[model samples]
Structure formats: structure tokens, C-alpha cells
Target chain A: MLKHTPFHDFHVQQGAKLVDFAGWEMPLLYRSILDEHEQTRKSGSIFDVSHMGRLHFSGKDAVTFLNKVLTRNISEQKAGQSRYSLVCNESGGVMDDVIISRDVKNWILVCNASNREKLVKHFTKVRHDLDLDFDMSDQTEGTAMVALQGPKVIERVAGVLPVDIKALKRYQFESGSYMGMLKFTIFRSGYTGEDGVEVIIPAKIAGMAIKLIAGKTDKPDATIKPAGLGARDTLRLEAGMPLYGHELTQTIDPLSAGLGWAVDLNKDFIGVEPLRKIQADGPKRRLVGLELEGQRIARQGTPVLLNGQPIGEVTSGTMSPTLQKSIAMAYVDAAHATEGTTLAADLKGTQVPAKVVKLPFYKRAQ
Target chain B: MLRKKAMPDAPKDYRYLESHEWHKREADGTITLGITQIAADELTDITYVALPKVGDTVTANQRWGDIESVKATSDLYTGVSGTIAAVNNELTKNPGLVNSDPYNAGWMIKIKPSNAGEFDKLLSMDDYRKKTGH
Candidate 1:
């Protein structure tokens, strides 16, 4: 059985087509993927990301435990600030990508839904070594996460929550109350390449809050439509972001996936040795963005060919809503991975011509 | 290519199938083919269409083409055994025509039937409705 979110019925009421994705029964789209995608790019859209995992760490040695567990340095982060981080195995391969936030008394780590149980087990085993009094809890079941994205999301969300959100910089969050009834944390961060906020609230009041936000008619320009995982995939692809299972996995290192900037060599952390070796010897294969010449969108695991020989495989592909052209990301042999180089992606029996472009196929207007 | 208006009824001119495909017997021996409204509604907005070669022989109850949407992909089955005569090339540019007008301009393929007698094996309007659960 697939897990259902608190807003499952609300999605069905709004004409969403539901499908199972990574064990969660979520909406694929309400009406049309293109319409929802365009709406998010032009104005705003709301997504029910409640299925994502949230874990809280509270202990006297919280900072010490985090420094040992996370690849990025978490000891220096000021309270109320968040940063992207990674969990890796001893071999220097990525285990999971996470966002680390420092609260006053505890540290909050948000992880991907599919990796929740596995990550909990990994952290449990390493907890005893840090010499800290810490309690780890998976708060995903009781939390409701909603993302309001696009340029006007701040103004629309600020009308309801009691906080001066204007002062919140990117990746910064603060705890605030909504309608004097619910306490939650609002983060100025989102997966989509847009200005947005992700609100984590109590699961009980989730449906009511969504209803209230969707019912707002005074903000005409801020139209809130329910988006599903389908649009979410396409949106993130256009932004040149990597999916955990697709572009990122335990077998691949961050350097090969164009994420070298996230690693800090000064910190002694797990997976540092292999990462350093990969940086020195260069990765066998590198990830690249493909701008397809035809309309047939490449799919994951599709073979990439150069000079009629298989060179790599596509990790993610879709018809980009922002660019209107077919776009894809794939890992190919480093010898053939260069911007402006021509490649072919085998789709079924046909080979579609593609050009190796820079990372992002679509960029938000400056 | 001209767009077809949604008729009040499935244009009485075309033959219907239980699997929600439409066949239009032309003045010539050839026939034009497309998916019906029921099938289009089920498939939603068509993203890509893959049709067989023009001269390939298509057997009844066999796969001739395929259509894909964001969520699902379904094979286009042959209702009558025939030789591929022509295909709607416009669909390459605008596949949404399959969703907007499935009977006329959205016609997928044209066929020169080898066994015209087999046409009787397909469903009528009443039988098609029952088979589609609509």
C-alpha cells in the first residue's frame, strides 16, 4: 500500500490524477502538466511535499554529532540558517542529500522520503560514537510540508502567517505561528529555481491551512494551483537539479555530478578519501545536459551514443516547460563530455541527435 | 490540415470498434483510421505518436502504432487486417490534434484492407459503449 498525504482528498477534489511515486500516493497533475508548469513559471503554484522526511536531533552534543555525520560543516551555521548537505558512505559515495538547519536546542535534518528509514538506521549506529546525549526522531508522519513558489509567493503567504517574511534571506528560516493557532517553521528555500517558501506545519491542521490559502481571492495575481510530482520532476530538470535516484545514487560521487562546490576538504568527514581521489584522477564519466533536436523526450536509462558507439546513459529527461524544447541530463564518458559536442540518444529504435549544452537548459529572468 | 468540429454524435459515417478506434471507409477501396473520443479521453493530451511505415502490412489484432502521455503509454491495435496506405504527418508537429479531434484531422493511419469481410467482426455503437464501460 502506498502512503497517503494529508491533502490526498484535496488533490482529488481539485481534479488531480493520482499515482504512486516512491511509495507515496501523490498527485501527478490536476489538469495538464504544461498548464501547471507554465503557471508556476509565470506566477505561483502550491505543492504538497508532506511526504518528504523530516528528522529532529536534540542533545547536548548535537553540534559534535552533526559534524561527524554530515559531509558539510554544520558546527559554524548560526541558528535559524540552513544549508544543503550530503550523507556519504566510507567509500565516498553519496548516500543521501539533505538540508541541515540549526535550531536553538536541536538540529533539524530534512531528507528525501525514500531514504527516511535507511538514513535513520545509519544515524542510529553512529550516534553512540559522538559521546553526546541525543534523541533522533523521524517527524515525517506528523508534519505537513507545503511549498509556495514563484515571485509573488512571499506576499501571498505573508498575508496569512504572522512574520515579517521580507527580512528572511534565502536559505534562512524562522519559527512563527499561523492565525494564532499553529506553530511552524517557514524556510525561504525551494527545489524550483524561484523565490519561494516551504512551510512545515502540524499534520492535523494541514488540510485546513491549504484550504484557507487556496481560498484567498484578494491576491489576484497570486493564483495557487495544486501541483503534483509530474510537474515537480520537469520543473527541477529545467533548473538543472539532480534527482536522488536518477542523477544521484550511492555509486556516484558528487564531483562527477557537477556538485563539487558543495564539498569542503578542510572538514574530516565520511567519504572524503574517495572524493579526493576522484578529484585528482578525474571521474570516469561526467554528467551533462542534452538539448535534443527532436520532440521525442529522452527517458532515464536510455543509451547515449557517440560515433555509433554507446558512451553513457541518460539520467533524466523531459520536455522542458520553460524552454519548450526537449531537454535531458545524462552521464557520459569524460572524453566525449564537452559543451557543444554532438551526441545521440537512443529512444526505442530511433536515435535522436542532441547537443551537449551547459548545465541549465532554462534560467529564470534576472 | 483543417480541424474537425466535434459532431453532436460520432459522425455516422465512420465504423466503430469495441476498443474505441474509428474507421472511415472512403470512396476508394482505402480506409482512414483514428482513435475514438472515449479512447482520447482515456489517454488525455497526446504527447507523442509512433506510427508504422507506410507500406508495412498490419494484421488485425496486432500493434500498428503507440501513443504516449505524461502518465501512461498505450499501443494502437489494428481493427482490420490491411496494408498501410498513409499516415497523418501533421501529428508530428501537433499531437494534441488527437485529443481535440480524434475522428477526422487526428486520424492516425490510412489502410488498404486485404480482408474487407473481417470488418463485420468489429463492434457497433451499442456494443462499443458496453465494451468501454462508458
Candidate 2:
């Protein structure tokens, strides 16, 4: 059975085309994917991301337990702060990429929706074996998440909310009440590489708050529109954010995927040994971004060629709505992964010429 | 696959296949083939279209071409067995025409019917509509 979010009716009312995504019925687009993607880059847009998983870890050993399992250091995070971390298996392969938010008494971990059940099962096994005092609770069912993203999201959101969103630094969050509902967390963080906010609110009161927040018009700059998963993919692809199944998987190690910054070697984590070895002797394949010469878009599973020989495969590709060019992310031989290196992607019968550009094809001008 | 949905505006005289392919018989006894509007919408911006060469024999329900969109790759199937008479050469330069006029200028191929009997086996426009939940 497909699960529906509380915002399902709202999306339909907004003329969204709903699709089955990661076991949940979610909107693929409210209007044209091109319009939504362009609006997000030129102005701002809102997304219903309630399908993502949310886990709350509390008790005295919350920090200790997370630090032991996650690749990033959770113990060093200050209150009201969020950090990107990777959950890895014994071989240093990334299970899923998550954001760990540390509050006063509990640690909130936000992960990919598809990995939620599997992550919970993995956590249960670990909790039993480690004999820790940490309590893991699945709070995804009751949470309604929305992302306000773009260059003008800050001003758009500040117009409605009573709090000054500018005061909240990146990766920082604060609790606020909207429409008499005390349950809310406004995080100055988003998947798109832009100035944006992700709001988590109680499921029952989400519709009212979403209407109030998105209904207002920024007259001088019409920046906010409802975006869907289609826009989400293009926006994140331009921003160079790695999707779990695409750039990362249980079989790929974190260090090879250009996520070494998130790993702290000083701390001993669940997948430390393999990571240490991989760090010492660099990984065979490196994830890099490709900028195709023409409008021909490469696709996932398309072979990456170096001098007419297959090296690696493309994980994700799309026509960047903002750049108006074809861009893709692929894993290639480390030697040819450097920026400016020449490569070709076998797109059906033709091999499209491409260059290894920097990860993000578009970055928010701050 | 393009789910069969009822498009009341769609020409009821034509028939459709489950693979989202649509076929309409002209008064001249030739079959004009193209993707439905709903199928074209699902594909968004049609970038490149790979069509079968003219004069090639195609079987009923067999794939005749591939449609490449910014979002995904989808197979274009033959709704009826026929010999390829002509291909939409304009789509190679202006693929967006598929989304703009899928029923007319966006017609992918013209097939010379090999088995005119296959027409009876296809779904009517109403059946196609009900199957797609349109």
C-alpha cells in the first residue's frame, strides 16, 4: 500500500501530479518541472519533504551512541546545531547520509525516507549488541517537513514568521510557534546549495502553517512557488548534493565519493578501519561531475570512457534547468577524475564529449 | 509506461495501446502513429527521438523507437504491425514539438499496415481512458 502524507490533499489541490516515490505517494510537480526549477534558482520555492525519515535518540548515551556509529563526530556538536554525517557499515561503505541535530536532551537524525525502515532495523541490532541506554524512536510518521529554498527564501519566510530568520546561522535551528502550535523547528539548512530553511512541524497543524507561510506574495520579487520532486532533483543536481542511491550506496565507501570532510579519523567509529586503509591508499574510483559539450543529456548506468575504454559509470544526469546545459555525476578512475580532464559518456549510439568540472555546476551567490 | 487514462477530448475514432502508443486510421487506409498527450506530458521536454528507418517492417506491440527526455528514457512501441512509410524528421531538430502537438505535427511515424486485422484487437479510446484512470 502506498502511504500518503497529510499534505497529499493540499498537493492535489495545487494541481500536483502525484507519483509513488520511495514507498510514499508524493508530488512530482505542481506545474512544469522547468518552471519550478527555474523559479527555485531565480527566486525561491517550497517543497513538501514529509516523506524523509526522522529519528529521535534520547537518554544519557545519545551522543555516545551516535558518535560510535556515525562517520562524523556527534560529540563535538553544540546545542541547536546540525551536522551532515554518514552511517557506514563494517567495510566503511556508506549505508546512508544523514543530518544529526543535537538538542538539549535528544539527538534528531534526519535520513532518506527509503532507508528509514532498514536503518531502524540496523539500529535495533546495534542497540542490543552494544547494550547502550540510548532510546531510538521513529518520529517520521508524526512529522511534516517542508523546505523553503532559493536566493530569496530568507526574505520570503521572514515576512510571515515572527522571528528574524537572518539571525539563524547555517546549520543552526530554533523552536518557534506558528498558528498556536508549539511544535516547530526552523533549520537554516537545505539540500539545494542556496540560502534556505527546512521547517519541521506537527503533522496535524502543517496544512494551516504551510498555507499561511506560502500563501503570502513577495510583491517586489515573486520568488516563492510550490516545487515538487522533479525540481528537487534538478536543483540538488546543480548544487551537487549527492542522492543516496545515486552517488552513494551500501557498496560504496564514503572517502571515495568526495565525502572525506565529513569523516573524522581521530574518533573510532563503526567503519573506521576500512576508511583508514582507503584513506592511506586512495580509492580506485572517484565521484566527479561532468559537463557535457552539448545538450545531449547522459543517463545513469551510461559508461564513462577514457581513451575509448570504459572506466566507470554515470550515477545521475539531468539538463540543469538553471545552467541550461547537460550535467551529470559519475564515478571514474581517480587519475581522470581531476577537474578539466577530458572524458566521454556513451549516450546510446553516440559518445558525447564532456569535461570533468567541479562538483557544483551552480552555487548560490552569497 | 503511460497509464491509460480516459481523455474525452481525444479522438474517440482512434485506438490506443497499453504502452502509451496511439494509433488513428486515416480515411485513406493508412495508420498514423504517435504518443498520447498524457504520455508526452509525462516525458516533459522531449529532447531526442530515435525512430525506425523508413521501409522497415515492424511487428505489432514491438518497440519502434525511444524517446529521450530530460527526466527519463522511454520506449516507443508499435501499436500495430506495419511497414514504415515515413518518419517525423522534424523532431530531430525541434523535439519539444512532441509536447506541443503530440497528435498532429508530433506524430512519430506513418505505418503501411501489414495486418489490418490487428485494429480490432486494440483498445478503444474509451477503454484506454478507463485503463489510465484519466
Candidate 3:
């Protein structure tokens, strides 16, 4: 049986096309993928991100335990600030990419929905092996998450939220209670390359919270319409963000995936040694962006060819709604991973000409 | 319990395959072929349509072409064996027409069917709706 999020019924009411995502029955699209994508780019859209794992940590050893496992130095993180980080195995391969936030009293970690259970087990084992004394609890089922993302999101959301979310810089967060009843945390962060806030509220008050935040207008042309996982994937791909299962797998290292900035080589983490070696020797293959000639999408595992020989494989591809072109991310031989280099994607037997481009296919204007 | 989805209107005079292709027999004895609205909705945001060349032979229940969306790809099949009379070139540049207007402007091909009796073998509007659980 598939698990349903707190907003499952809300999705159904909005005429969402529901699909199984990471063992959860989630909305693929509320109206249509293209419509929602355009809506997010142009105005604002609300995304149900409740399926993602939310773990809280407390106790004296919390910072120490996090510093031992996470790629980033968690001890340096300030209260109400979030930092993007990665969890790597002993071999320096990425386990999951996550966001670690230092709240006022406790620490919060948001990870991919698919990696939640595995991560909980891994954290537990690590704590036991290290004989640490932190209280780690998975708060996913007890809370709900919603991301209101787009250029217009901040202004409108600021009117309803208790705190002045517009004043919060990127990666900053604030906690407050609505109507002195519904307690929530608003994080000025999102997966989509847009200015927005992700709000977490108690699971029981999800329906009431959405109503309060989005307002009473539920028309199709409402400023904040409900988008789904489909638009979220496309938006992130356009933003050049690497997804856990697609780009950062168990065998793929963060350095090779062009995420070295998130890894701290100076810190003593679980995978720091191998990562240091990888940084010294350089990555064998580097992740690069590709713009195909036409609308033919180079799907995952499609071979990227140079001079008719396979050089790499595509990780993710989409006919970008924002760019109106076929864009993909692939790991190519480091020698050929330069902007404007010509390559081809072997779709079945046909070769579609591709050109290496910059990582992000779309960027919002400041 | 999931709510029953209302079936998109399938023309009474047209015949449909379980795979979602619809065939309409024209007055000129040619059959116009296109995917049903259900197929278009399922394959959201179609990005490309690869149709067989004009005058190419298409076999019954065989793959004639391919249609691509942002997230998935599906092979196009025909219910009637025929010579490709004409293919819609507009779909190459604007495949979204398939989703917006699947019946008329989105018609993929017009085939000069070899066996006219094949149309009768296809499912009627009522049967197709029942089979698809509308």
C-alpha cells in the first residue's frame, strides 16, 4: 500500500493526476505539467512537499554527531540558518543531498523522501558506532511541508505569515504561530530556482494552514495555484540542481557531480579522506549540461557520444518549458566537459546532435 | 476510494482501439487517425511527434510512429492497414496541438485503408468507454 501525504485529499480536490513517488501516492500534476510549470515561472505556485523527510536532533552531542557524518561543517552553522550538505559513504560516494538547519533549540534536517528510511537507519548506526548521545527523531509523519515558490511568492506570502518573510535572506528561516494556535516554521529556501518559502506545520492543521496561507480564493487564476511533483522536477532540472536518485547515486561522488562547494575538505567527516584524494586527482568524469538540437529528450541512461563513441550517459532530460528547448544533464569525460563542445545523444540508434552548455538552463532575473 | 474519471467525448461515428487511437472514415474512403483525448491527457505536455512519411505503408496493430512528451514516450499504432495518404506536418513544430485539439487539428495521419471492413472490427464509442472504465 502506498502512503498518502496530508494533502492527498487536497490534491484530489484540485483534479491532480496522482502517481506513485517514492512509495507515496503524490500528485504528478494538479492541472497539467506544462500549465503548472508556466504558472510557477510567471506567477507563483504551491507545492506539497510533505513526503520529504524531516528529522530533528537535540542533546549536547548533536553538533558533533552531525559534523562527523555530514560533508559540511555543521558546528559553524548559526541559529535559523540552513546549509545545503551531503551524506557520503566511506567510499566518498554520495548517499543523499540534504539541507541542515540550526534552529533555535534543535537542529532540523530535510532530506529526500525516497532516502528517509535509509538515512534514519544510517544515522542510527553511526550514532551507535560512535557512541554519541543525541536524540534523533523523524518528524516527517508528524508534520507537513509546503513550498510557495516564484518571483511573486514573497510579497503575497509576507502578508499572511506572522513573520516578515521578505526580510529573511536566502537560507534564513523563522518560527512563529498563526492565530496563536498553529505553530509553524518558514524556511526561505526551495528546490526550484525561485524566491520562496517552505512552511512546515503540524500534520493535523494542514488543511486549515493551507487555507490561511493561500487565502480564500481557489479559482484557476489564483496567484498561488497548487503545482505537483512533475513541475517540481522540471523546475529543479532547469535550475541545475542534482536530484538524489538521478544525479547523486550511491556510486556517484559529490565532486564528480559538480557539488564540491557543499563539501568541506578541511573538516573531518566520514568520507573526507577519499574526497580529499578525489579532489587532488580531479574527477574522472564531470557532470555537464547539454542542449539538444530539437525537442527529442535524451532520457536517463541514454548514451552521450563523441565522434560516434560513447563518452558518457545522460542522468536527466526534459523539454524545458521555461527555455523552450531540450535540455539535459549528463556525466561526460572531463576532457569533453567544456562549454560549446559538440556531442550527440544516441537515442536508441538515432543520434541527436547536442551542444555542451552551462549548468543552469534558466535563471531568474534579479 | 478514487473518483471515476469522466471519459472525454469520443465521436459516435468514429471507431477506437483499446490503445487510445481513434479512426474516422472520411467520405472519400480514407480514414483519419489520431490519438484519443485520454491519451493526450495521460501524455501531458507533448514535445514532439514523429509520424511516418507521406505514402509510407502502415500495418494494422503495428507501430507506425512515435510521440514524445516531456516525461515519457509512446509508440503510435493504427487500427487499419493502409498507405499513408497524408501526415500532419504541423505536429512536428507544434506537438501541443495533440493535447489541445486531438480530434481535428491534431489528426496525425489520413490513410487510404486497404481493408474497409477493419473499421467495423474496432470498438464503438460505447464499448470503448466501457472498456476504459469511464
Measured by DockQ, the strongest candidate is 3
lDDT of 3 by residue, A1-366 (tens): 999989888988877889999999999987778888988988899999999999999998999999988999877789999999999999999889999999999999999999999999999999999999999999999999999998889998889877988789999999999889999999999988988999999999999899888764358678888888889999999999999888999899999999999999998998899999999999999999999997789999999999999999999999999889899999999999999999999998999999999988888998
**CA-lDDT, candidates in order:** 0.82, 0.86, 0.91
Winning model by lDDT = 3
Q: How many backbone clashes does candidate 3 have?
A: 0
Please provide TM-scores, in order, for all candidate models, with all chains considered together. 0.89, 0.90, 0.97
Docking class of 3: acceptable
Clashes of each: 0, 5, 0
- Under CAPRI classification, how is model 2 graded? acceptable
Descending-TM-score candidate ranking: 3, 2, 1
What tens digits encode model 1's per-residue C-alpha lDDT throughout A1-366?
999888887776676767877799988776667766777887788998998899999877677777777888877799999998888888877888898998877788999988888889888888865556788888898988988887777777877678878889999999977667887898999888878888888999888878666554224344776676777878889889888999989998888888887777678877888888898999999999999886777888889999889999999888776786888999999998999999999988689998999988777876
Cα RMSD to native, each candidate?
4.1, 3.4, 1.9
Model 2: residues with Cα > 4 Å off, grouped in runs? A179-182, A216-222, A293-295, A348-350, B1-8, B25-31, B51-61, B80-90, B110-123, B130-134
lDDT tens digits by residue: candidate 3, B58-128: 99999998999987999999999999999999998889999889999999999999999998999998988
**How good is the docking of model 2, as DockQ?**
0.24
iRMS of candidate 1, Å: 9.3
